[model samples]
Target: MSITAQLTDSVKLPNGAELVNGFAFEGRGDAARRALFHNGHELEVYDLYEVFSGERAPAVVFPVPWTGWDRGVDSVSPDATFAVFSGQRAVRAVGSDGKQLWEYRHGCWGPELGHPHTGDEQEVCRGLEHGSCRVSDDGRLVWAHVVHGADEYDWQEYWVVLDARDGHELARLPLGSAASGSHHVSHPDGLHMGLCIGMGQDGILLHWARWDGKSLTSWDVNEGLDRILMDVHNGLEGFLTVEHDGADLRLHALDGAVLAEGEPESGDDENPAGWDHCGGFVDTETIIASTVDSEEEPDRARHWILDARTLRVRGGISYPTGPIASYARPLGDGTWLTYDTRNGTLDRWTTATP
Candidate 1:
């Protein structure tokens, strides 16, 4: 029952070259404006417009270079600002329109105990595993994960919080000692943030805090869940959806009380291959997940859509030539706008209609 709509528009740059990174649509129907980020020569932004006859034109353009820039735009701030992290640099920009509002540069350090070697043997190790930059609801604070030094193999971890107004360091948290699979979740209130500290190299630890102007209160969730997805419903009621190894996917009250845990009508096995570089969220009760299949075996690849609430398989789509990147964001009209980087296309589909 899912209906899909495709919108195609190419952004023309200054040098007669066309720039495309898939259009990011905001709003609904005719009120919607598609945003394009051009990776040509340098990273530039463009505001795309549709004319009276359905022709598209570039309304504005600008530049930004924050490396290792990944998805999760909505986590940055609803006002068109984007959070980006690369190497030892973390920055947030108001798309291509505004300059870098804040930036944190980390000095180089040697490798650590549990560090994994990448690239050729002669190259210097870039210790960044995964870093995310996020903004507060009021656009007053920006949060980012900053990993430094070459000692990534050891148990030392550090992160920083920045003042979104002046780009100043507000506080720093050092996750002392060892472990793997550490994840972070920022509450929709923008005043509170959570750190899921994974211990025993296999267990998950939950720590919550309030990002007051000066300090943080240490609150811990004792449930010992493995994985957590925070503010999944766009910060509606502060409820968190959690997935654990032995337990079924459950929704917990913001206070860490289990609300509901059972197999929804759309449930399915949480496969291993799906977890790699995959992320999605629940819109109301519909859980949307986007995953890629990458096995060493030749010609084996595809993507999937699942009901996050029911955990049931809704549909499966294959990317034959592989995609450069893909992202799904919940629009207000009960539909999702997917950006497929492989073919530079934007597709809109409704979960309710599916």
Candidate 2:
């Protein structure tokens, strides 16, 4: 049966704050918190905590360099001391005061890789294609997906792990995929991270990696599927993935076995409804997913609650308020976030008991 989504709490973003790739919830249990990068005149981080208890200001704020578009997909450390920007040509780390902590230069992700005649800071801001970066749970390591060389002849994309203190390349794996863009899904254990490389129509590449102190080991999980990797379980047991075409959602074990699959029933067989790439474990046994893209009208998009263990759709989540945006981000603590793109407000929601 369907459950109502009760409004619990909310926090308005700072003035002039424009979200980059929306906000993310990190940590688990009491240590859980939210992190978001807002790009306006410059990039800034808003690390928020205790939103449900009451309205809280950003616990930490870090300023980053470059425009939001040029930053590719950036991530801030859990402690909010630094932010790593996955750029068009480099993955850079910057301190709260905008000081450059470290930078790892790589091949350009720009479409016009051959047009680069001079090397300058602005040169890294010229492309629309790029990768993403994320900090480990402990904030000791930074995982990045970058093009491996500076020239066309040797250009290749790789998943690299770097020492967070300094930009020392610790371990790397050559990703044999032509990436239009990519993102990393941080495993709760801190040692393992999942990468989803989007190659457009060519299909998506899913890779799981583990860092065991000395080297980085990785393997392919989705051999021939176009799945977009989502969140990992709180216990590090398995993760979630939705197909690129929104065909279905699958729960994959740590070893890459499909435990269960769920495809919401479509009203019209001619236009089968599918889940959006956005969604995650709401808690240990439940999930919050949306089908906003399946609807032609923006307000008609809906979110659904599903059985995380079996990938079974429990029911659609009804908002006491009006319709939300296209995505529902779960915090893994039974609470999820819905953004109001119009007013820049993030509302926390919890499903009411039936």
Candidate 3:
């Protein structure tokens, strides 16, 4: 017996707006995700559904001061009062009225900005593509990475908690992280936030933080290992799912204890490329993964479902529409999302007993 996702829904984007992760920002409670369009001089956000359904005009449209394209929107507050934008040397909080609430400005995107990993006299800018900011589950705080002491020859990296109503730095923890850039995910617990930094060949860095009412505390789970932090399973408290060396998929506690591990099967007619990444989790117990090894489009993908708590294969999944990327997204419900970047559509799917 095997489990495979059956397509349930597909939503296309408005023209000019590419489908990017977190670009279509939506919270668990939100009725729809806000679709953003940033073309340098102007930044506009259409109610992802309002425009798609022809129910209303763009929810919010504003003129932007910057000319460079923003990588993506970091986060939209749960209350929909504000949105955060991130990119090279810029992190800004904008109000629902399309006015600047507050801004955090820094030097070039990376490197000569005194970044420990890439700072060189000649190195100029290193832009980030991730919308790395996250709002707490309670909607009281926003967690972000702000460049600290950036002017000195070597700058510091600080993960911070911000005032959601007004852009104010509340508390921060110093992480001597030397990565090219990073992305973030929220924990089920409102006060906890997780980070994954990519450093190319140097490997990945995983940082987890908890913002108590008074202060903030954080620690690294990398353990000097060469692995990439992949997904955060809020359903399983304190356990952060990760990918080691881009192959070994494992579940780890915040303290760096390995709870479960999944090894890539050798490539054959059954599993492609000797083994590939797992899809992390489906609900709290079901974890799905793909055997297709290529990051680029795979003509076909074979999925394996595993017991999230035991790291044992429970079943296999197959794609009817075609191959999906190694990453299969769990929708928190019984369903998950599958995508092909080349096709530019996010397909909602679910497991079917076959």
Report, for all candidates in order, the number of backbone clashes: 22, 1, 4
Clashes of 3: 4
What TM-score number comes out for model 3?
Answer: 0.79
**Model 2, position 85: C-alpha lDDT score:** 81
Q: Model 2, range 172-204, lDDT digits (tens) per residue?
A: 998888887887888877788889888877999
Q: lDDT by residue for model 3 over 170-199, one digit each (tens)?
A: 887776665566667767656677777666
**Model 2 alpha-carbon miss at residue 302, Å:** 1.8
lDDT of 1 by residue, 53-166 (tens): 344444444344533433323233445455333233334444545566545655223354665556432233443344445555566776655555555443345556777666
CA error at residue 217 for candidate 3, angstroms: 2.0
Models ranked on TM-score: 2, 3, 1
> Local error of candidate 1 at 145, Å?
1.3
RMSD of model 3, in Å? 5.1
Q: Order the candidates by lDDT, highest first.
A: 2, 3, 1
lDDT of 3 at 23: 33
Q: How far in Å is the alpha carbon of 216 misplaced in model 1? A: 1.7
Model 2 deviation from native, Cα RMSD in Å: 2.7
Worst 10 residues of 2 by lDDT: 14-23
- Root-mean-square deviation (CA) per prediction: 8.0, 2.7, 5.1
